[model samples]
Target chain A: MFFRVVLGMVLAVASCGAMAALQIEITGGINQGQAIAVLPFEQPAEVKVDVAAVVDADLMRSGKFSPLPRSGMPTGMAKDEELLKADAEVAVTGRVYKEGGAYQVEYRIVALKGADRGKLLGHFKGAAPLDLMRQAAHRVSDRVYETLTGQKGCFRTRIAYILRRDGAPFPYQLMTADYDGYNETAVLKSTQPLMTPSWSPDGRRLVYVSFEGRRPAIFVHDIFTRQRTRLASYPGLNSSPSWSPDGSKIAMTLSKDGQPDIYYYDLGSKQLVRVTQNQAIDTEPTWSADSRSLYFTSERGGKAQIYRHDFATGKNERVTYQGKMNLSARSIPGSNAIIVITQQNGYRVARMDVDGSIYMLTTSSLDESPSVAPNGSMVIYATVYNGRKGLAIVSADGRFKANLPSSSGEISSPTWGPALDK
Target chain B: MMLMAVAAAMSIAGCSTTSGSGAGAEGYDGQGVVTGIDSDGAMTVGDPNEVQTYNGPESLREKNTIYFNFDSDQILDAYVGTMQSHAQFLRNNPDAKIVIEGHTDERGTPEYNIALGERRARSVARYMQNLGVDVGQLSIVSYGEEKPADPTHSEAAWSKNRRAVINY
Candidate 1:
């Protein structure tokens, strides 16, 4: 449960003032990735947010590059040979200026004289409002990532998480912000509790459990329209709503039957088809990448562990055995691995292969509710720090970790939405 | 006649009406509060114009909350008397309603903790029904770890958080 102090956050009529976005601090990381140097961008005085710093931090946080620090940066701008001499594989230099009251940045990434010598990966240009310099920087980072790795970049995506504001009327707020935890806007606020926000594939709507009417119910919130539809309000538990890959149906945990089990609620007909029927607790239903099967956490074996339910074959099998308890699992897109909260000496986020091999991905003792980024490069989980719950992100390989601190109240159940169209 | 009798009894006791059962019978629209028990350990719900009382053990008022061990929903023997008092009160007042809010500490996964919390609340609801409380009179809600009675993460806070609170 969250910190249940009375925070008066009435949503129906009360307006919410914007609060400071979460400040992301990389808590732990390894400097072993490919070396890269980002020169301090020459910028107009109107652009306040550091675009180069944002790009540098993005590459560093991905655990894929070792960006040279400000001290290691060359005076003015370094040439391709100087970057090679500095042991850097790539150099990024940029210039920012103002055009028609908007800020514009032009940057170039060049590979050093090594594997791909003097390769101008791309010449990129980005523009935004003077205050939205971070978005412009993130666009540049996405282009750089795609150019280097040949994979789509998630830098331009948004993440939605539950923020428990510590005031009276409406304490729980569903917030969506940039992937770096800036430009936060409240999606919904209520005096009651909200949990487990899952984004639709298009990132246009979110499904989450809310207790606005003093009961646990699943709601689908349209991100743009602010319209909500109550999808499930069974007599008992109607929690853990996850959209299918096709967005045609939602697999959720419902206790309207005998026990809490995974049930698929079709959006068109609104018919519920039970997926699991054991007396044990079968909850936290997440769809596989292909939407052919579901991975859920069940206590049917007497301990909380992950089990897979195939929709086509009706086969149910345990997928995790390396931990005493494993729950809150999500299938990492574009891979055969699924990230889960596995308990070893303590609960930590781990990557479990479909064949039963497990790779621990976090160092925190009390990590839970892991959500893999749409690109499957990073996982976000909630951890307790200084007696308060905060959001933390770790590279899928467990090499780099970052923390996003929300001083308002406890943050929980973060879901990384799909990559947006920039 | 019944309203006058209940109001006279409330006046005699001079009880505070905070966290009490609502005003029952005769359309008396007044807020009721449950206060300290009488010398005989009877629980009383006092309204501005009426009072309803239930006979129970001295600890019944203090024992409305049933605490549970970690990941358990079994009711202990010590709280049986308190629950019986609650069941008897419901039987005496069929119009009275109650909500059992099940909660858990911040230990297990949230979805499972939600099921665990519901099991705890349902356990209380079933026990009260077996003691003659109608099923229609009682409803259950599981807060899981989402609403901790105590915010600390220590054992003290956890023990307090894992509980079924009987709300009238």
Candidate 2:
């Protein structure tokens, strides 16, 4: 499908030598985030920063809700009737006050569905230092996500993406930001490409495939200790590293044995176990929560589609039937649904239930890499937006939307960080 | 001539090895040079028809590589004609094959580029396959930026290095 598009692209590129980036990239979870509205936290106090806007973005990045912009509000947010009438499932109300060089925030969320029945699902109140307002908002969204999906929310989760600066010898820099694209910090930088970033289940360490040694190898970097170790460099292909849910093993692709296949490496035992015995392309492997099976895309089925290989029976069965081309498959945190790149009409992220039925999330041109939030309520993967390495978030059902166009550079292979409980 | 023959044979075989200790040449650099010359592209030395061998005369043939921009896996038009020639060669010589090795300029994430490079090579591989080249003779390897065309640490040099090499 990508090849077919290439021909059309030739004509398109020839017509407009400058084919601007027109896609957005979002990576999160797949509860199919809710589109709740947050009326700009009434910032009566002179706190130059817009905390509510940050929180709104935080919620959007989780791929949950398409927050209604305050500018588009037909009326003021103070009236509960207007807030409820906004048609958004939920509405946020908050007020900030200065207390002796500190800021106090009190917020509440109303469920529009229960308004007619005189029942309110959310009544949250918290007050902390001004700097922690973002964290406070995340906590609120975490509650909103949980209330809506019955599962936990990934608002408190982190995301790791790469940023390439213009002049740096190794423009590729690894950075971690909150789920809402805030609090970005560059973790690693080099002129060489740093890639395939993954998070440990505990959220304390990050493992990525880096070429610092002139060959692709898996590296586990401890966030607290700031120490990193090379996990594997399997002679040929050593990339696409995904951690086991238990944090004991890493499922990756290696061609050292000849032909691309799935392999699992035990962290403690330092032993390598071969998983998929395939001669076709079998890379990008993700483990089921139970860690009993591995999900990947293989062309043995005539074309690349999602398939499952059980560890016990070792039987590999094709799971995706909707489209011929499906490359990226990320299992929703606690659900049987897997979000993947399906090529039905074009390259876009689609979700399939346990049995393998495609549900296209983005109606855009190119959407790759689907990552779910810790809650499975939101899916945040990377896609191009207007020629930049932008991010997009879509609700599980593929309705809510928001675009986070990075002002920096191209961004890809985004891995949703687990809940930041630590 | 014998050393050249060995290099040529390796290229003719289209063996893109991640490690070079098998080359037997003491000073072999992992840059794919093996010894003194680049074994890719137009120039042909040993038997071009030979298909397989560790170090045969076919290795001396220059490999056709398509360079890419930073962090991009999209195949450019500049490489289309080259891929067409590659397609023609593989089609003419049914026994002959090509392994598209994707490489990225050292500017993004290595894992992403590994995937990016894989996407690049696979793009070409899939394109060639779509053009009627048999998939069996075609294999792909994404070195990410592990193997660069130019070892020097410069933007211009890195741009040239981020390329997919066609071997065989």
Candidate 3:
């Protein structure tokens, strides 16, 4: 089910980019996608593995191009000439072998007929259980996308979410895994409870809500160090801690002011300034790319909707009105669009042009908490699956969809980290 | 808040109900605040200098607990009526030390349940404080949703779990 959505997008992408970027034979109908082939990989001493099929699956998810199947290739042509005769604009070839208890794989892209001919676009060597065979494929696919279209691809990004375990009493933990739902790791844990796992801009740490001592408090945990520090413990309520773009401060919702309202706390100064004084439920704060304005959901208008608050002017404006309830609003980087969860006939997540045009993402699901990737190409959010709460990610244009598929009991409230600094 | 409301109503209920009849318990249960009855149905609640006392009912010995609504930290309206007796007992015994533990059901996010639990505990603490218990002497801790008196996954179990127990 997930593969099909992405596969459809791969077709759309291949056509769009081929028409705009490549001066290929543009037919009366949509360009029938760039036909790409995967030549058998080079074998290193002692390691013999070819990962052409994995690359095929990776690229097809982008709705970009259809890879000529392994069975379709006639066995005799030279690797170079075979790709050329097939009209393949780009070719993916890789080498995989095992050494020192780890798998090493190198991915490459060779342009068949273009200005940049036989280009060694990308190379990655790593260990396995990793879907290395698959990621190796995505790396090559990304290379082709970048080499021809000149734009970065988000196939390698990972998402972090909160999951409840099935142990004696529920254990809520923060989990981080790849976009394809592989290689998962627990970021934080709690016996009392945990919610809202948000990633730092640099992807080095996580900030989330925890009930460690039976009080709703926020903790900042360093992924590498495995150490955590309490950031807030107000007497009444402290929640929805969100990081500013520059990672300087966190904007959150605190009810210590007699009612739930938006508040901004300076990470450096240790001072908190109440941002929203309304007596209504105001929460789910997110930052604009520049950190100049804050977007959040407030029920001041009688129902939850997206609103913008400018720090410089101390003025506010309503940004979403099409839905009766627009709880989560996250701005996609480099685009004027904000992914928000709207409840019209039913609850669903949609990407809306900051002004108002909405592109519905999930058709049937109880979706909430949408977080846009740093690149703004995809949005990850929380929803229920099989009656088990979980997280879902989809391309910004709604071309691809995937569930984090946590082994833990259920998952929710995911926030995308800024790209990994390393 | 509902807890405080409980303590207030308990005091009001004391005036309406006649003195209770129970061995060694009536004095602390249904009695008034100023002059408390001892276990013998005698005034045990004394003034500040005398460790002031009140006569409580024997029935209250089994009812030291309070109940909360589903997904709510707010004390139930029924609690105010019963808690008024507790406020009277506290007034009668100024030196008595009491602890309130807040709890919640298994539903909702854990963080949310914890917050809801604290509010429920505070509700009781505030009520007691308003009814003349020294704020400094009263201590409150939120157990969040950690310990449940009943382990059933049903709403019945959850309602019973969302509670604040007064321990002296």
lDDT for residue A263 in candidate 3, whole number 0-100? 85
lDDT of 3 by residue, B1-168 (tens): 111111111121212111212223322212222222222222222121221122234656676789977655566778886677777877777776666778887554333444466667778988887777777657666656545677445568777898998766
Please provide, for model 2 over A1-422, each residue's C-alpha lDDT reduced to its tens digit, 9 standing for 90 to 100.
Answer: 01111101111111110112222233333224565777777655545446566566656655546666666653223566666676667777776776677667766677776534224666666565666666766776677667765767667778887654433323456777776566665565543557778899988888887755445678887866656677887666787889988888999988787667888999899899998876666788888878788888776776677789888897988888887577777787778888888776656878888665677777765566677777676677666566544566777666455565665456666778877663
Interface RMSD of each: 13.6, 16.2, 21.9
Q: lDDT of all predictions, in order shown? A: 0.76, 0.64, 0.61
Q: State the lDDT of candidate 1 residue by residue for B1-168, as single tens digits.
A: 112224332221112111123322222112222222222222221233332233233445576789998889999897898798889888988987888889999876777788899999999999999999999999999989998888766779999999998877
lDDT of 1 by residue, A1-422 (tens): 11112212122211222224345666665466778888888887766767778888888778787787756566434566665665578888887887786777888888885668888888877777776677888888888888888877789888888877543234566778777667666676554678888899899999999876568888897878655677888999988889998888899988888789999988889798898999988999998878899999999999889999987789999888988889988999899989988888777899988688889887678687888887888888888866778788888877778777664568888888888785
* CAPRI class of candidate 3: incorrect
TM-score of chain B of each: 0.64, 0.63, 0.61
- By summed lDDT, the worst window of 10 consecutive residues in model 2 chain A runs over A1-10
lDDT tens string, model 2, B1-168?
112333322221122211222222233224332221112111111122222322212433453778777656677888788777778777888887666678776443333346567767877888898888998878776777555566444568778888887776
